[model samples]
Target chain A: MKIEKKDVEYIADLSRLELTGEEKELYSAQLGDILSWMDELNKADTSKVEPTAHILGLENVLRSDLPEPFPDREAILKLAPQRELDFIKVPKVIE
Target chain B: MNNFETVIGLEVHAQLNTATKMFCPCPQADYKAGANSAICPVCTGQPGTLPAANVKAVELGVKTGLALNCRVNEISIFARKNYFYPDLPKSYQVSQFDRPLCEAGSVEIDLKPSGSKTIRVARAHLEEDAGKSLHALGSRALDYTLVDFNRCGVPLIEIVSEPDISSADEAHAYLTELKRILQWAGVSQCDMEKGELRCDVNISLKAAAVKELGQKVEIKNLNSFKAVKDAINSEIARQTAMIERGETVAQDTRLWNEKEQKTVPMRSKEMAHDYRYFPEPDLVPLRIAAARLETAKNELGELPRARKTRFMKDFGLNNYDAGVLTSDRCLSAYFEACMKEAPPSAAEGEAKAVANLITGEFFARANELKVNPEDYLSKTISPVSLVKLAALTSAGKLSASAAKTVFAGSWGTGKTPEALMGELGLAQVSDSVQIEAWAREAIAANPDAAKDFKNGNEKALGPIVGMVMKKSGGKANPRLANEAIKKILAA
Candidate 1:
């Protein structure tokens, strides 16, 4: 599929990124090229192969449900950009 | 309005009652703790941190799926639902997308006045909970929102239903039954006040002449079951009015305003976030072993519906009594324990008596104390004590009113029913000599009532019995009083 300027703009909007007109055109072409190069996989005859999420072939890597509270929670909260008392503060989001 | 039909579907998010969060080892017990006190690097989405699935959460999800009559897929993949929100520090939520753990389930709900309908469940997928965002605190609005990560990373399962609910009452029944099942299976507490259970509603209208459904609207922020019902009704009215005015309703997301009793549009369809879902690479696919599935099925022993049916058939309880008793798992277990305390010969005969005691006096006291009836079973009143009280009332050793008095006295005192009855002077006077004298006095006082009773007006005996009970200070066995009054009138 061909990547167009509108497609690039939509992607930019979804990613919460700003793009200039020239950047949009340039990204569109670059994205088209990348897609075309990735399309080479379509030539392979792998129709019989089952799709897999991971190649490691491992499953059910789980932990028992036990509460091991991390010590020093204050250190974690200190990494916040802004703080109000014990809470992390951000601009209000009404919705 | 008569020609149009309302269609509704529900998406319920129930926080699993696991000891730890879904992915990380953070404690999930105390959401009420100080803000950000429960956070860790894994839950806060620190860079390069990986998540390990909680096995208990998976078992619970499978158990719930089996309870809902769903097929448990042997392998289910976790996906990342990408979004941008301050509450979601990961910028993407780890959830089940295309391959859910459970799918194609159905929940049966009882309709009013006695029919039943099955609401089809599309899927029940496991996910993680986001943090809490507080915009205002204690009537004071803040310029910036405060975020609490204590609730973050908590395990949640989203049960989605097909568009089968047709009315507001059906929606209410669906939620009630769903919550009951969840709680019965020990999957979640399903407490709306604690934010353990949350719901979102999708509704649409279809005209009689049109084959396609009207624009679907989603309503959110419904904190209670009543809010869910009221929101659906308000949306139905709004949509009906719009249709009557020949106006086309636009598809949008709305928030139910509890104060205004109306739904206000929160965002248009165009502004909807595109949650580009992809398989989560950090976690491996969950493969349910056959042994694990069997264990889950074993854990889900006797679902609410089955136990309710047994209560009706085995205990001779009516549908309403069975429904009330089986509504809570703890309450049902308490009832069973009371029954077990009964003698084998008297168990079946006394089942109804035990049920009445629980559904009547026990529940009434529970309400008065603002406590759960099941909570009082072992905490205050033991099952043996309650069963003995029922036996006393059944054997005519205590009158109904006297038994109620004994129950009130015995509550929270750890006193036996017989002891309370004697101490409170509320034991029934079963002696024929004493009852005959009281009956004779009552007959002498109420001559008109005695004459009417002699003339075969059985209703007139009520006054005579009332007088006898009064003379005996409510300690008279009412049945014996009635028999004495009839014998005196006959003489």
Candidate 2:
């Protein structure tokens, strides 16, 4: 796969990141290198290998459906830039 | 103008009734819980936190899949649905892609006024619920949004339907049947009120003669079944009008503006979302063991359609009555419980009578109590009491009016129907002498009607009966009063 500047820009926008002209060019080239490397890696013959979602080889890492509150809920709630009461405040998201 | 056919497909998100969220052990209990209260590092997307899948969620998914007759995939992988939203702490939702846990199950919806259609189930996949975004604060005091992450990691199963529904009514029937099945299977509560079940409707209009489909418009935020039906109908009208005006229907996302009763564009085509979906690296592929799959299939009870058919066949109920009886799983179970209390063999051919009481007065009382039939059974009236009431009404010992009184009283007070009837003096007054006196008074009060009745005006008989009922203060057995009035007019 080839990486383009517009693709990088679109990805950056989707990630909610603002990119400068220079950073966009830098990321575009960096992504191109990363993609070529991935393509080179993909060239290896592994036709019999099963597709994997996780590298840990864990098939079913699960927890019982038991609810427990986070120990430091207050600290976590305080991490948001803006909060009212218990809620994290942000710009209005109209549906 | 052209004749157009409306085609609608639905995507329903039903929150699994699991104790914990999908990827974390945070309590799913408090959607109303204080924001971030239920958050764990994994659910809130803290740095370097790993998610462990909730086993109960997958089990419920399998159960739902089997109930819907979907092929449950032994293996399914979780993927990252990448999007930027403040409500989604992870910035991407963990959902199933490509390989879903269940697929290709169809639900048969018996449409009202006649006929049935099989709606093809496209897929049902498990995912996580995003936290609620509150814009009420923006409209209230400040121009800002509030987020509650209590629902952040709650597990959800998204059931996507094939575009087989060609009319708004069919779409309604499909949702109704799907909700009932899921609810009956104990997979999810499927309550639209609390957002347990959410629907997004995709619809488009095509010329009846045209082979290809038209531009698809998605309508979202339909909170209730009626809203779903109305939204589809309104969207169909809107799209049909747009096409008739020689205008191209642009693919856009619309919100059901319930007050306006029309869909308004929420996002234009240019602002459409591009959800970059890829497998999540944090979680392993979900594997359902053979034993778990067996349990899921075995645990499913009689589904809504099967129960409805059985109710019609076994109890000799009509289609409408059977449908009403089995519409809610709780009600169907309650009816069965009532039958057990008064088994059909002992019911003296009044099994249908018990069904009538259940679908009629008992349902009304249940609604009035604002409790489901199951709760009503445990809290207010027992199945035995209900069966006895039905039996009494059937045996003519308790008049229908008296039975209705007992039914309502039983809900208000915890007393048995017979006890309530005794305490409230609502028992049918079947004393022949007392009924004769009331009838005589009724005949004397309406001399003209009596003379007309003797002259063979059967319609005049109603006035005398009405007078007798009024004289009896509505406690008189109506059938007995009618018989008494006929005898007096004959004499």
Candidate 3:
């Protein structure tokens, strides 16, 4: 489907985009061009071609019916943006 | 009373039984360990890493749908549900919207009022899971929430049911049966406590004429079955009160604040723009070949409801006992393994009584030991032992009360029930002479108690029987000993 200017703005808002009018209009046209390109691509002569979803075609990859070691507390806390003792710190929400 | 009907639907997210993460080779990991450790660039939505779909995850999704009586879609598409969250590394969750993997099935839930009712399964789709969110300073605990990426890109099968549930109880039943079926089909462990198996309920209350339906208020964060039930109950009351006050229940999501035991609005209702879903070009349509679907179907041993009924018919077990047995795949297998070892020929009531040991004594003992029975189930106990113990009680060789002691002793020492019985000299005497001799000794020693037994003070039969059992050193089965004592006293 072709992307309309209004639809682009709506999408931008959903995406939390903070754009000036000029940037919004610019992105609207760019996105519209991309959608039109996809539309053209849809018209390929290969009618028998199946759409692909996953990269690898392996089916039913499963873990053993056992629980392996979960990450330890130290390993998990290392990625926290801000940490004290061992927890991810976010802005204080409770008054 | 207002003539209103409640419409309830459920969306259950069951983590599939896969060895690897949904799109990567990271060990199908745990969520308890916080951020980044379980993550790879592919899952973290790194600038350039690509996701290779986990095919087995899709088969399980289809297999799950088939068990729920859903029709596996020929070509199912994956889409990106865009939302910005710290825990979601990609900032957009890859999901299915229009063409889900499976469609149009139903799950049968046991209704207390009626015998059984089938709730329509709207669809079940495959999706990638989000990462863990740890509240800082009890921040998320208190309001400040932080993200942990450990769970990101985990494969999940979202099973959504049609709005067929009329009450909260049916919703609860539907979740229960769905979890049991998924676990039994060897798809997922379905441990709700672990959040491996989780559920969110959508409930709306509308007047009888309001066929268009009222706004749906989705309830989330119900960890246990009891919590889910209570949330539904309280939500119904709250909705009813609002309706009575002539207020509208908005379309929004609410959290079941388990600690507070109340439902609170998580966010105001949002339009479709909230999570703008668009086709995901990274992945291709999931294909279901007829042979594969059939294979998956054959692989599914039995659904919970069907297995429960069959357990009663084939094993002569009761409904409650059968339900308990089939709640989880491993537990059911444990019961069957015990039966296989002790087959019905060896014990008349082994099937029913075996479950009692598993759900009762075994579970109780395992709890005391603080080890999950599932961890030791395959190794520690034998069905033959269970059957032998039950048979002893049945043949009047051991009393029911005595069987518990015998089982604990045998189980604790890892000795065979027969061995324990022999060593403890708990074997009951069936010999007429031996039984009579014990009874005669009891009569001579306890003349007053024996006379009371004859004079119709039937309660006095207790001490005389005790004397016979004591004379036999508690090895004699009390039932036969009592009978022998009664006969000898009468003569």
Candidate 4:
């Protein structure tokens, strides 16, 4: 599949990234080359092999439901860019 | 309206009642907790933190799926739903997509006038809850929104239903049944006020002749089931009017404005987020072993519908009474416990008596106290005491009205029904000599009523019976009072 400049622009917008016209063109070409390189795997006859979501072959890695409170919650809250009292403040997001 | 039919489906999110968050060891923060008091490295999306699934939450998801009659998939993948929001510390929410935990289930809803219809469930997928956002504090609006990460990473299961509902009432019934089943399965509390249960509605109107459906409008921010029902009705009216005017209904998302009781369109830009779902490599696939599935099945003892049927069949209760008693798990358990206290020989009469008190007086008191009947059951009145009260009423030792008085007197007093009846002078005057004296006095006071009864005007016997009951201070057994009055009038 070919990655167009519009596709790159759309992805950048979704990621909340502001890109210049030159950056969009550059990313488009770079993405297209990456896709071409990954597409080489399509040539292999892998119909017999099952699709793998994870190569670790692990399943059902779970923890019990017991709760342990994080003692230093204040430390985590201080990491935010802006904080008011106990809350993390951000630009108005009505939606 | 006649030419168009309404189609609605609901997506309900119920928070799993696990002790901890879905992926982290942080305690499940209370809704009334301080802001950001439950944050952790994994839930706050700090770098280099890994998320492990909660086994209890998965078991609950399977239990809920089984209760809804969904086929539990052996293997389900958790995918990262990419989106940007202030409430979500992690830009990507780990949820099930394409391959869900449960699929192809159906919930049977009780329609009015003694009918039932099945609503098809498309899928039920497990996901984590986002944090809460506050736009305004009290009455003051702020330029920046406040975020509380206390609710972040809470476990949730999103149940999606097919568009089989044709009216708002059916949607309401569907939600009611769904909530009952979820609560009965010990899966979640399903409390709407506490945000343990939340619902979103999808509705559209299509002409009877058209095979293709109209544009679907999604309604959000429904805080209660009434809001859900009203929003669907409002949306139906709005869509039908547009269709009648030969205008196409725009496919968009709207918010239910509770104050105005109408749905208004949200900002167009709000719909631009494209959730790019990809499998999460951090967590492995969730595979339910045979033993785990069996354990879940065993945990889900009996669903509400089956229990309702049994109550009707075994206890000989009417549909309405059985439905009320079996509505809550704790209430049904209390009812059964009361039955166990009754003698086996008088099961039928005692069961009916017990059912009446539970659905009538017990529930009334619970409502007055603003408590759940199940929660209020053993707190004041034990099952043995309640059954004793029912037995007294059934044996004619206590008049029906007097039984209610005694019940109220015994509530929270730890007093037995018999003791309360004696203390309050509520014991029925079933003695033959006492009843006869009251009956004669009643006949003497109302000679005209006595004459009417003597002339075979059976309805006139009411006043004489009322007089006997009054003279005995409502302690006279009404049935015996009727016989006593008739004997005196015949003489």
Give the TM-scores of the predictions, in the order they appear.
Answer: 0.92, 0.87, 0.83, 0.94
Q: How close is candidate 1 to the true structure, as a TM-score?
A: 0.92
Question: What lDDT is reached at residue A16 by model 4?
Answer: 89
Question: Per TM-score, what order, best first?
Answer: 4, 1, 2, 3
DockQ, each predicted model: 0.78, 0.69, 0.21, 0.84
Give the residue spans of candidate 2 off by over 4 A: A17-30, A41-48, A91-95, B29-31, B138-141, B267-273, B346-349, B404-452, B459-491
What lDDT score goes with residue B90 in model 4?
A: 86
Candidate 4 lDDT, tens digit per residue, B188-248?
9998999999999999888999888999899976879899988988888888888888899
> Distance from true position, residue A60, model 2, in Å?
1.8
lDDT of 4 at B409: 80
Error of 1 at B13 (Å): 0.5
lDDT for each residue of candidate 2 in A1-95, tens digit (9 for 90 to 100): 66788999888876768999999999888899998999999999889988766788779888898877678888788788989888898976666
What would the per-residue lDDT of candidate 1 be over residues B1-491, giving only the tens digit for each residue? 78899999999999998999999998985756888878899999999999999999999999889999999999999999987788889988899999999999999999997899999999999999989999888799998899998888999999999999999899999999999999888899999999899999999999988899999999976879999999999999999999999999998899999999999998534345589899899999999999999998887889899999998988888898899999988889989888889887885668888898889888877887788654766665788888899999888989887887778777788899988877887788899999999999999999998888778898999998999999999888899999988887887
Which structure among the candidates has the greatest DockQ? 4
After the best TM-score superposition of candidate 2, give how far the Cα of residue B432 lies from its true spot, in angstroms. 8.2
User: What's the iRMSD of model 1?
Assistant: 1.4
TM-score: the better of candidates 1 and 3: 1
**Candidate 1 residue-wise lDDT at B366:** 81
Decoy 2 TM-score against native? 0.87
Candidate 3 has an lDDT of: 0.76
Candidate 2, residue A34: Cα displacement in angstroms equals: 3.6
